[model samples]
Target: MFKTIKNDLPASIVVFFVALPLCLGIALASGAPLFSGLIAGIIGGIVVGGLSGSKIGVSGPAAGLAAIVLTAIGTLGGYENFLVAVVLGGIIQILFGILKAGVIGYYFPSSVIKGMLTGIGIIIILKQIPHFFGYDADPEGDFAFFQVDGENTFSDLYKTLKFITPGSALIGFIGLGILILWEKVLSKKGKIFQLVQGPLVAVVVGIVFYAVTQSNEALSISQSHLVSVPVPEDTASFLGQFSFPNFSAITNPDIWIVAFTIALVASLETLLCVEATDRLDPHKNVTPTNRELLAQGTGNILSGLIGGLPITQVIVRSSANIQSGGVSKMSAIIHGFFLLISVILIPRLLNMIPLSVLAAILLVVGYKLAKPGLFKKMYDLGWKQWIPFNVTVLGIVFIDLLWGIGLGLAVGIVVILLKSYQNSHFLHIEDKSNGKHRISMTLAEEVTFFNKGAILKELDSLPRDTFLEINLLKTRYLDNDIIEILEDFLYKSKERNIDIKLVSKRGIVENPSSFIKFFNERPKSEMSLS
Candidate 1:
């Protein structure tokens, strides 16, 4: 892991800059103590990173869980009560890992996964717009369409025009310019430029800008629009910030319910992030999904013990890590250390950095993820892929993260069923021969119950005085539902004056009396000609 330290070190700094405000913002969004988010970030990075098999994936307090955490805290009675749930949730996650349930992540369709990444990118872009203009009405970690502020995603954008802070907006543009310059020009010029990332530069400039303009009333950035890390006056107060879980609350059934909920949701979100992060990695390294669950479980347990929010492998931080050239788990561990050391040593300095700079950095990240070219690429894959992709994207924009993926997955399943229906059988018709219409229907390989409707519909549509040939030579395994349908069709064929012939590898049968009995007498295990 240390072999790539040169790359990982720089990437870790970038991720550190990215994760800082997010930790604070998600905690704020969850209505938990501000320090709790930072704690989650620290534990997610160090503990989870140490145990995880992912080379470039980063874990943290996820924005996707903000709503769940918020309600869990209130429903459980208090933050201390909520801590018990988080710990239990971690245990549940560990069980999930031990059970080897990580394979469930592989069931998600590629189209849905791509749609998820694109939707998140678009959300990041939309959510950051207001912050870029210095309107801080919404927390940076609130990614849902409906917000706790009662002003939804779009409404906040409309309101931004009325409340934009002049100083923050100016500095935001400057920060964006710096990032763009580094990405498109400066970074390409030298190894030194690559070592010192653009986001780190923008953050430094933002801090300097805020410090210098503090005296100018018209240009001074307000504390409200800056990163808000809780400042501890001394060691005692700092240590006091940590809260312990209420063990008495463990007996409460509600705590168990909340714990199960967190375990399920956090595991799901982590699995999804692992899938997406692997796709984003330049080296295309595959992370052990089960190991990731175990790592997250351990992180959440430690985080809960110390009064922190629940942890999950976060796509935003992971993607930022990969894009910034992170090649090992060390980047994640280093970022956690940065979070811990900074909050302990220089939280005051962190508070001075403007939020607009971070927003600017996210805007670029968002753009890269949702680049217009991806739309065309997905579309070119045809409606089977395009419909689900678009549906997922729209659902995510209009609803929330998980819902979007769910909607997309639903659409994708429907598309698969439709394709199955069409491909179940190949029907070829010939003009009148021997004073009768002739139709040949060939069943597909491995026909299942899903193909019953299509086959039945075709059989029912046969004309009177038609000669129908049922070809099962290509079919390896025929579903019982379809066999029943074919048996029932025998009665209809006689009534319609339709002559029937069954063609198979065994032999030709003239209007077989019983489809089931015919298959039962033959070799059942291997139905194919070969």
Candidate 2:
């Protein structure tokens, strides 16, 4: 990890710039203390990054958990009481890690996962539009279709257009221009450009822009449109910002309910992010999922004890880390330290940077994730993959993150069942000289209850004067439900005057009186074709 510091240091700075506003925005959206978001960011980076198996994944306050945190805090009676639930949730996540529940991440369909990344990308782009124009009504990092402020995503954009801050819009455009030039033109020119990332340049330019325009009433960006970090007057007051959990709240049954909910949601979001970050990793490194969960659990526990919102492996920060050329976990750790040091020493300076600058940086990140090429790529994969992928993206855009994933997963499962039903058996029809129809049905390699419907349909469709051959020579396992279907079909075969030949690895039997008895009594070698 130390070997990559040359690359990691620069990348960490970029991630710090990216994570700072997000940490505050998510906290603002959650109705939690703004400083709590910074605490989660610090612990997520230092503690989780140290213990996690992921080289690129960065843990922090997740936008995905904002809604949950907001509601839980209200339900728990107070922010201090909510801290109790967060700590308990962390404990539960640790137990989940111990039980190796991280394997659940693998069960999600690839299409859905990709859809999630693309969906989130689109959401980022849409949500940042208002902020990019300096519309400060809706908090940054709130990605839900319906916002807590009673304004929807599109309505906020409309409102932003009506009340655009000239100073903010001007700086936002300048910041965007600098970022584009840095990436597309300047970076290739020299090492200096590469070391000094586009975002850092944009931030510096934004600060200068704000300072220069301060006296101009129409051009000056307001405090609402700037980065807001809690300014501590002295060291003691700075430390005073951290709050301890109300442990007595643990006795409340409601606290445990909230705890379990947080544990479940945070663990799921972390697992999904782990998978996404691994996919986004240029080196194709695979993260140990269980270890990630354990690390996150520990981070959440620490964060809660110190008055922080819940922590998860957030895709936003992780993606920013990867895109900014983060090569190791050190980048994440360094970024955490940056957050710690900046808040302590240069918070007022940080507060001077325009939110529009960060919005510009995130706009680029969002574009990368939801590039037009991805949609075309998914479409070319065929409906089996594309439908679920499209549904997931749409669901995430129109609804919330978890619900979108669930909707996509449900669609993916349905697609799998359809494929299973279709591939269960292959039918080949033959005509004999006597006008009798001969149908040969070959069972799939593995037969389960999902195949029962397809098999029964073919059996029931047999003509009155037909010969049916059911072949299972390729089958490895057959479900009891299918076996029962086959048994019941035998009685139907008699009424239809159909002669049945059941062929298996054991042997062949013709018009078996009792299908079960024939299979049970016959030895593999002794059975004869008759």
Candidate 3:
């Protein structure tokens, strides 16, 4: 790790800049003390990053969990009580790791995961727009469609246009320009530019912009539009900011319920992020998902002990780490130390950075995540993949993160069921010389309840004066629901003037009576022809 300090140090600095505002923003969104976000950031970086098997994944207070945290805190009666839940949640997550439930992450469809990344990217860009223009009514990191402030995402953007601050907008444009230059021009020119990332330059320029415009009333950015870290007047006041969990709340049934909710949600988010970060890793390094859960659980436990929000493997910060050239876990660990040291020594300096400038940096990050090319790429993959991918993106944009993913997963499942239905059987129709239709239906190897609909549809559509052959020679398992459909169809066959022939490994049966009785009398392992 020390050998890569040259690379890791610079990458860590970039992640620190990226993480600083987010820590405060997520806390603000969660309705927790602003300092709690920073605390989570510190523990996530130092403790979780140190223990996690992921070389590039970064853990922190997730924006995705902000709504849950906000509601959990309120439901639990107080922030201290909520801390009890966080700790318990951590224990549950640790149990999840022990049970090897990390395999659940692998079950999420690739299309859904890609949709998540794209959706989050789009949300980041959309949510940051108001901040970029100096509208400070909504908190920085609140990405939900319906905000805690009672305004919807797009409505807030429209409202922000009416109250734009000149100073904030000016600095934002300047910061964005500097970032664009650093990445597109300067970074390629020399090692110095590469060593100093665009975000760091943008932050420094924002601070200088803030200081220079302090006296100009119209051009002045208000404190509300600036980074707001809890500045401690004294050591005692700083220490007072950290709150401990109320162990007495542990016995409360409500606390356990909240704990379980957080543990389940946080574990899932972490596992998804682990998969995403590994996919984004340039080297394609796979993180051990179970070990990641354990690391996150431990981080959440420490974070809760010190008045912090729940921690998860955050895709935004992890993606920022990867994009900024983070090569190892050292970058994540160093960033944590940066969070620790900066809050202690240079918080006031951090407070000088304009939120708009940070917004500009995030704009670039968002663009990278939701690039236009991804749309075309998904489209090129065909409707089967594109439908779920597009739905997930739209769901995240219009709804919340988890809901959008759930919606996409639902759609993906529907697509799978449809495919299964279509593939369940093959129908061949032969026109015989006797002016009758001879149809042969072959079942797939494994036919489930989902195949029942398609099979019934074909059977019902058969015309009169037809000879139908039901072939089950290749079928290994036929669902009982399908058997009932065939048994019922046998009675209709006579009324429709349709001749029935059933073929299976057991032999052929022509116009057999009591189809159900015949099948029920045969061994389940044996094929029944009736």
lDDT of each: 0.92, 0.91, 0.91
C-alpha RMSD for every candidate: 1.9, 2.9, 3.4
lDDT of 3 by residue, 1-530 (tens): 78877788888988888899999999999999999999999999999999999998899998889998999888989999999999999999999999999999998888999999999999999999899999988887788999989999999989988989999999999999998899999999999998888889889989998999899998999899999999899899999999999998788999999999999999988998888888889999989999999999999999999999999999899999988889999999999999999989988999999999999988998899999999999999999999999999999999989889999999999999999989999999966748778999999998889998899999999999999988888987777888888889999999998998888787888977766875677776764332
TM-score of predicted structure 3: 0.89
The true-structure Cα RMSD of candidate 1 reads 1.9
Against the true structure, candidate 1 has what lDDT? 0.92
Per-model TM values vs. the true structure? 0.95, 0.95, 0.89
lDDT of 1 by residue, 1-530 (tens): 89999999999998998899899999999999999999999999999999999999999998988998999888989999999999999999999999998988998889998999999999999999999999999998999999989988999999999999999999999999999999999999999999999999999999999999999999999899999999999999999999999989899999999999999999999999899998888999998999999999999999999999999999889988988999999999999999999999999999999999999988988888899999999999999999999999999899999999999999999998899999999999967888789999998887888888898889888889999998988888887788889889988888998988999888899888888788778676765543
**Candidate 3 runs further than 4 Å off:** 1-4, 431-436, 463-530
Indicate the TM-score of model 1. Answer: 0.95
lDDT of 2 by residue, 1-530 (tens): 89999889989998999899999989999999999999999999999999999999999998888998899888888999999999999999999999999999988998999999999999999998888998888888688999989998888878987988899999999999999999999999999999889999899999999999999998999999999999999989999999999998789999999899999999999999888888999999999999988999999999999999999999989998999999999999999999999999999999999999999999999999999999899999999989999899999999989988999999999999999999999999966747679889998888889888888888888789898888988877666688788888888888888888989877888888877675556555543322
Q: Supply candidate 2's per-residue lDDT for 527.
A: 33
Identify the superior model by lDDT, candidate 1 or candidate 2. 1
Residue pairs of candidate 2 with colliding backbone atoms: none
